[model samples]
Target: MAGISGLKVIVKKNKMKIVVLISILVLSVSCRNKEIKSVEKIDTSKETEEIISENKSKPDTSYTTDIPHIEDFQNEVMKEEDILFNGRLKKYFTLSEFETVFGQNDSIKLLLEEEPCYTIFENKDGSVDPEDKYLYKEGSRFENSKDKVAVDEFKFTKSNFVLFKGIRLDSSTSISDLQKIFPNATKNIGSMDVYKEGKVQVIQLREDENNVSDGHINIFIKNGKLYSMHWWYPC
Candidate 1:
């Protein structure tokens, strides 16, 4: 009976050892699987980072061809007859010539001041005179209110004028389009860039240069659209 009891104890010990061995084997396989999954996750994360880096390094080629080189505008001469003021292709006009085309019967108001040197012609209602709303320097002469008075500067608060190249100086003009039109324009003065062609100057404003006023051309722009244009003659 004693020998039989001893044999049973030995069998129990062997069964316990087998159970521990099986548990160890299962634990080893679990650890290996976890390690492989961790490696795969790290590789995936690295690949994702690499893709993002490559995308960020890529150059933006969308607007490259749209904006022409500044050199393209160098030595470019626009015809004087192409500059339009109220459909009149004349950079500067005499008061007589203006009345001749619009007829002498038109009602226009002329405000002549000598202190600051300005001669303004507006509508009878004190609004923008599309036919003739110009500001000139002092000493500008007009014989009988119908004589020639070289326009020093003009304003287009209500008139629609286009450049020789069909570039409209209205509220619909864009800064980019303006840059393309006058590639030689200066960087920016306040909210607008000034382009000069002899006695004429074209001023364009960005969204930022609209608030400050200095009596120059007040170009109004909203949401990248030119809404209004003011032309101040270059002194």
Candidate 2:
């Protein structure tokens, strides 16, 4: 009887030990699952932070702005036309074959009579014969000289005239145009940047029709107004 009792106690103790082992197994599985969940959360947080940091490192450079209108440019062109026709301007120019790039002003007149020369000596080369005895218009020179003006001083700097190819200009053209028109004369224009003298402007041309010129000529501006001009011809 005592042996049977002892066996029963051992069975009970074994049962208790089995129950504790199962509980420990279950607790360990739960803890491992919790650890996996924590690892996932940590990885997700690190990914989010990396994305935010990349965004912060990059800069946004978007370009969105309207261009400028050309009203002032148009007004300047009209003023140039007036000066071209007026007796005041005294610059030289030949026909401008180069068309306007902006579709602003396209048609310009090519007039030989505009020069007002009575006799033009035919030379073989592209040059003028100042002392050609065959062509003499003294009266034209005298009358144009009566309409002359002196030049006033303006602030001057280096010239950028090498950029242009011809003497003619449009409203879209700037002092840069003038600089490029005549490389040879641009150097001669010691003051350089003509526009530096805000007072000076390229208005009309004054010329001596009979004097014989090949290319452009220079005229002076004074005060606000332009007087007569002094160019051999061609401006």
Worst 10 residues of 2 by lDDT: 154-163
What residue runs in model 2 are displaced by over 4 Å at the alpha carbon?
A: 62-235
lDDT of 2 by residue, 138-224 (tens): 101212111221111111112101111224332234444444433333333322224334444334222223323343334333342
The candidate that achieves the highest lDDT relative to the unseen native structure: 1
TM-score of 1: 0.34
Clashes of each: 4, 15
lDDT of 1 by residue, 1-235 (tens): 9999999999999999999999999999999999999999999999999999998899877766666676543423334455565466464556556565433433333433232233344335644323333333221222123343443433333444445455566545676766666454433413544343122333442221233333343444445554444444332
lDDT of 1: 0.49
lDDT of each: 0.49, 0.36
TM-score per candidate, chains pooled: 0.34, 0.32
Best by TM-score: 1
- Candidate 2 lDDT score relative to the true structure: 0.36
